[model samples]
Target: MAHMSILLLVISSLLLASTNAHDFIKYGYNGANGADKWGSLSSDFSLCSQGKQQSPININKNTTNYDSNLKQAPRNYVLTKATLINNGINIVLKYDQGAGNLTLDGKIYALTQMIWHSPSEHTIDGQSFPVELQLIHRSSDNHIAVVAILYQYGSPDAFLLQIQDELEQLAKDKCTDEQEARVPVGVVQTRALERRTRKFFRYVGSLTAPPCTEDVAWIILGKVREMTKAQAASLKAPLSAEYQSNARPAQPINGRTVQLYDELHNVKKAPSSKSD
Candidate 1:
């Protein structure tokens, strides 16, 4: 019965994605058509305001409960040639089908795409990261799982640097079209997932973006990836002044329980795949 429910949810997500912007309206983080006005923007975005489980929420560790039943699933991501695009709002890297799969709760969800949000939409104890990477995956039946990895200021992050090099090119050219780039998805992604804590905060939430549908499975990693300030600035440079910070404000948890998995200890950081 549970499996059937997940399958049905996935079908709904696909249909929603197809007709999400049926009328073609612009929605953003701020201004006249900002987050606050999303529900009013159009009938399609009503969930952005009405949904009870919106994402990019603040994870208050103090109030969370540890759950040993949560599995530490492995993510087998393949290295692929992805198309990187500056959508004028955020930098998005779109991968081809069969590039990767994340096994969670005994089910495998195929990796779809990844997007960058500066100053992270989600916060920990009210603390925000310099940048956040959201890896999206979808099960064969339509259930969506989002893994949120936070990057802090420290040494340069190899994975980010690789993409950072291309960011400038796209920003300078102001290119709206996708630029082909070979990304080491396997090395970069796996390393991020195999964190020292082997821990994450899991909950049900809506998509951070509009058409904010609910029922998404969110897993936010506890470990923070390090990247130098210059690297962070390079990423934000692509956006216009107003969009320099694309992160949405942390939403309310809405009395939802956030399950934590922190049993795996002494986890070591993986070597950087900088050269790839």
Candidate 2:
């Protein structure tokens, strides 16, 4: 049954991405043109407004139960030549080959690109984080698995500082084009899947963006990474002023259950504002 679920998910993702690629319009997160109006923007984005299993949900610890079937996806990231794009909304990191790959339940998904969302899209127990870094993966068949790491204001994260400096440079000229950069090997993957406890929440949800395709496996790491307030400001500096909150609001979970996988059995019952 576990294998079946993964297979079906992969197939669903492939079909959705292919069918919705052309019509996958870009929508913002504000009134009229924001998330509330995504579905009406185009017939293709009907899922955004209509899907019952949308992402960026508010996760409460009490709402989840342990699932023995869930397994940790191994991270094998290699140094890669990457590019940074402002894209008006958020800063996106695009990498050439040699980034990394995730092996989940025997299925391999290649790390394609990553991006940051300010003020976080997903929250823990209705509490927001400083930022959320999303590492996007695509299987050989194009199944999408998003690994999100929540960030809080605190001691600076070395990897984040590296990217932050590059983003700050981009902000100087307000460059939105894909500028050359190098992502050190394992820098992007190390802290994401490797937490102090290595736990995560898994769910079947749609993309937070347009077309809002469903059946995309969302693997949200329980660990909350930290960066200084200055680092947070540097990240937001590249984004446009209007893109203040690039995060999407928490959507309804509908009837779906969020499964938790605690490999180390050390997840705290009470969520802390910052990660250990």
Candidate 3:
């Protein structure tokens, strides 16, 4: 536990050493994370485009009555056991050890790196949450299962409060003009990523962004974590100029089923804009 100022300074310093925030953190499709380069980075990341998956699905969790028999498998990732490594772009994650496998519907998907997006890239129950962290895990058979969680404005969630403090301390530059920063080694944990309950919405979909790759196991939860407005603002803050809207438009479901554990919950489409 360190002071806020100290953490921010550290992040600034690390990022400044080589790249700047604009390089990866900011929006626009020229540099790393810039949607334009997603295709060239890695073949797997190619799904960033060429996908026909539904974008944001707002969760207005009303029922916990549904029961899901989530087959237990060796966790592909140990949330707390991550080693932070920034590869040119924003920050690239590398696991300290091999993630065995994650079980869902009796299928196992090997653990892959979990990354963060700004201001959230999706919505829930038509109620747009502030942020969304997509945990991408792949199975040995090349199958994929994504556990998606939306951050909202309500009672603060323990994980969000913790991660906020950790990110704020990312290596900050000594000078204001400088860019790029470093986040402490031990920042997030896999344990925290697990939903309070195994109950979730399962659907056959594609990546929300480009490449529009289809056939991804999308597991979205009705649980929305509480985060402060400041925290929400911070996510979108970095990409203000180039990508005030880091989120993409919700793709067409095209007759896809947004289902809950056993029974399916039909989530209707959300209007482009809605008032709270």
Name the regions of candidate 2 deviating beyond 4 angstroms. Answer: 1-26, 175-197, 266-276
TM-score of 3: 0.60
What would the per-residue lDDT of candidate 1 be over residues 1-276, giving only the tens digit for each residue?
Answer: 999999998986675574234224666777898888888987778888888999879899999988866767667787666666566677777775566888888889988788888999899999988899898898998888988889888988767665665666766756332332232332233344433345688999988877887899998987777889988888777767777788878887889999998754325433434211
Q: Give the TM-score of candidate 1.
A: 0.82
Task: Report the C-alpha lDDT of model 2 over 160-203, residue by residue, as the tens digit.
Answer: 65566566676774543343223232234334333433578888
Ranking of models by TM-score: 1, 2, 3
Clashes of 1: 1
Candidate 2 Cα deviation (angstroms), residue 54: 0.8
Question: What does candidate 3's lDDT look like per residue over 5-106, in tens digits?
Answer: 899988866643321223433334444666655555545445545444545444344532344443222344454445443322223344555544568777
Model 1, which residues run further than 4 Å from truth?
A: 1-23, 175-197, 264-276
Candidate 1 lDDT (Cα, 0 to 1): 0.75
TM values, all candidates: 0.82, 0.81, 0.60
Candidate 3's error at 126, in angstroms?
2.3
Provide the lDDT at 89 for model 1: 70
**Candidate 3 ranges beyond 4 A from true positions:** 1-80, 83-94, 99-101, 161-166, 171-184, 196-198, 234-240, 262-276
lDDT score at residue 135, model 2, on the 0-100 scale: 83
